[model samples]
Target: MSRKLLLKAVEQAYSDRRRLVAPLLGFPGINLTNSSIKVAQQNYIEHYKVLNALYNEFHPDAMFTLMDLSVEANALGCYTLFPQEESATVLHSSFDESRLEFMNSIEIEGDSRALSYCATVKKMSENFQDSMTCAYITGPYTLAGLILGANKAAEMTLTNPELLDDVCGTAYEKIKTYAEMLTSSGAKAVCVLEPSAVMLGPEQFIRFSAEYVKRITEIYSESDIAFIYHICGNSMHLLEAMCDAGVNALSLDSPETGMDIKKACKSAGDNIIVIGNINPAGKILYGTDDEVFNETEKLLNETAEFPNFVLSTGCDLPQAVPLENIRAFMDAGRKYKLP
Candidate 1:
């Protein structure tokens, strides 16, 4: 498929005031009894197979890479605590002034789940080249938090700004490399998940998080591929900073951030292509079908004027979310009319 296809599709969606649905559906499963890094690598094919199955089953407007934000952190030498049935978390941070000194030399080589992530993304692109394919990565600051410990990393933003910025730069390079890999495999865009940015106020975020996020997005500015920025938590305050980062789209957790999508976009002008605020855990995962439909219907009604608005969750959908709820969410979007 032509690279321009996705760029054109998005452009047209905005021009026509046609809302597109691309929820962050990247879960491998919710029922895994055991999901060690070893098990994932050994059964990489099966993992991608399940991912593909979900995509086909739901057939969302767009598809994203698997839910594995820890892959890059693990590759960067941070130990991960893989859960029996959940996404892995960064268990140990392997960063310090010394580690930062040689960060430029670090590469995601052998026996790394980062490689598995790339392989799965490659296969997804190959299988769904005609559609808009996206790859997910931990945003620089978030990855830095994972590698340097969230509290310590946050403190560095205040006391050791230079060191934090430097470490974030290291993460920037690594994320850019991962983005390149995904694009090479067929991803038309990359979504940088930076949930940690919410830990800081807008001023600190601009310096510590947004700056580095911009660096990664800038790398693809002139290219056909786009970049989408997602920050978990209430991001109403950082909407301007996120837009200034020059990402093609800004994905927000509406319920968490208390952001009125249309209100924020109006203040942000027409450039902000907002993606979400749907309560993934609250409504889509645990709420009744009527609640899910009402929320989806409400969001659609709210953002009907903004063609740049795409309906999606505030973040990646949880593995345990009910498939019936997901279908209900999708159905709501499909059933809405632009009257």
Candidate 2:
């Protein structure tokens, strides 16, 4: 499927008040078990089947490839711990240098896990040709923190700025190449997650985070593949800066940041697709079905004026979140009455 079709569909939805409903669900636990994370993630067919079932059930306007942020980090020499029925996490860097000297040598295409990810994306692109199939990757700052140790990465941002810059810059190249691979395979859009950027105050965010994000977004600035920039935690303060980073959209977490999506819509303007800030764990996982429905309805009502609004979870839905809650969230969107 061509990238233009998905954009056209989203654009038509935008003008007609048919909000695009896409939860940040890559691998729901309902179809997975407490087995090795690699086993679950590498099984692309299983991943697609799970997503297809959910899409069939909910009929989302968008779907995505695996949501594991650790795939690239692990491929780039970060020692990762893949738990049974849990997302993969970085245990430590396989390399000792804070500069990430190993990045130039890391070949994501040759890496087995990366290959599986691309294959999954290709298949999804073929299967969900008419809908938006997005590819997910870790952002430079977050990947740098994983490699240099979060605390060490933070310290270096102040004490040794050059080292952190070099490391992040190198990580960005690897990320860009990997994203290109996914796009070539079948991803119609890309969502780059930069959770570590939240720890940086404004200055550090501009220096260490925003610039790299801009560079990555620029890679697709001319292409048909859309780019959505996401920073976990309360990035309320950085919303404008994120907008300046030149992504097609900005996704924020409302509960974590205490940010109003209306403000983000204003900051990002009508051209940017603003997605999410729903409290995935707090509301979607623990809250009752009524609570989830109310939250979703409230979000829709609050941002209904924005044509580019997309209803989604603030972050990835946890494996434990009940399918009933998921349904309620979608139902709320479906049943919402435009004011």
Candidate 3:
């Protein structure tokens, strides 16, 4: 854990003025193993095959588990749909407060699929010893959204704010338990995915998301685990608020969403590593190899002044993203040097 870590590796790379390249190579890398999304995510053996295959193909600096947002909700007894080729998702519905009480009684670690996620990381640590072993966990506010339904959750924020807080506090407890399990399974870092938080304004975002995230960060600070706060889409307006969460890193979306990558790097300062700006579904998927290479090199150069930075995608890449494009993107990272 001490040596196969994130902060030290990023700091060393920063001092050397080198970039750590770690795309959110989740479902797209499944092509490397010839496995379906459902099978690979539920079975640790299949999951390892995909991740190990990704490492063999790209040899990126860090290895991330599949970017599935539904695992925590499914573990809580929510009605989740598992398509053979896509990530599982919780169905939208109204829920009762008593349901949260019922879900609280259900053990999160007891869920077989949730346990498989830990096993997937366990397998990663055993094989990808030299690379950073990163895992993704549900953010408490986002999990509360799953429990209360997205629309209801947002409405509750304005109407019955207390009710939303109650649900969020309970959800935080569940996410914390699952996070501890991932840590025990040997995860060096965990990214708190809070895609739903995009619906909240700065103040509400802090109250619902960042505050709980800060506590989670404190819990793992003793173990030296790097906690990254990742909210999908254009979180440009919420960047400073996200920084206040006290995590080690912040992964942002592409500039297509009007996000200013340079300003994000400057705002995070030295405490957190700024990762990403490349659109997962952008040039890397539809453009030529040269285009992919140019875009990556440009992004690397734009944020080059910040030592605490990593080259990554704004979100998880699609499973069909051309392999040659990923190769081209990695090529840019490998070839670039700070000017």
Which candidate achieves the best TM-score against the true structure?
Answer: 3
lDDT of 1 by residue, 157-276 (tens): 889988888888888888878887778777777888899888788888888778887887777767878778888887888888888887777878866557677776675565556788
What is the per-residue lDDT of model 2 for residues 1-339, given as tens digits with 9 covering 90 to 100?
A: 234434566578766666778888755544543334457587776666666666666777788765787888888877888776677888854445643555777777888888788887887778874557888888888888888888888989889999888888877887888888889998888898898888888878878778887887776766787778888878888887788887788878866557678888888886778898688877789989999998888888888887778889888887778888888988887776555
Global fold similarity of model 2 (TM-score): 0.92
**Mind giving the per-residue lDDT tens digits that candidate 3 earns over 73-172?**
8888878998999998899876887887887788887889889999998989888967888999999889988888888889988999998888898888
lDDT of 2 at 200: 86
Report lDDT (Cα) of residue 216, candidate 2. 77
**Clashes by residue pair, model 1:** 234-257, 254-277
- Candidate 3: how large is its RMSD? 1.6
Quote each prediction's TM-score.
0.90, 0.92, 0.97
Q: Model 1: how far is 224 from its true place, Å? A: 1.3
Ranking by TM-score: 3, 2, 1
Total colliding residue pairs, candidate 1: 2
Which of candidates 1 and 3 reaches a greater TM-score?
Answer: 3
> Where does model 3 exceed 4 Å of error?
1-4
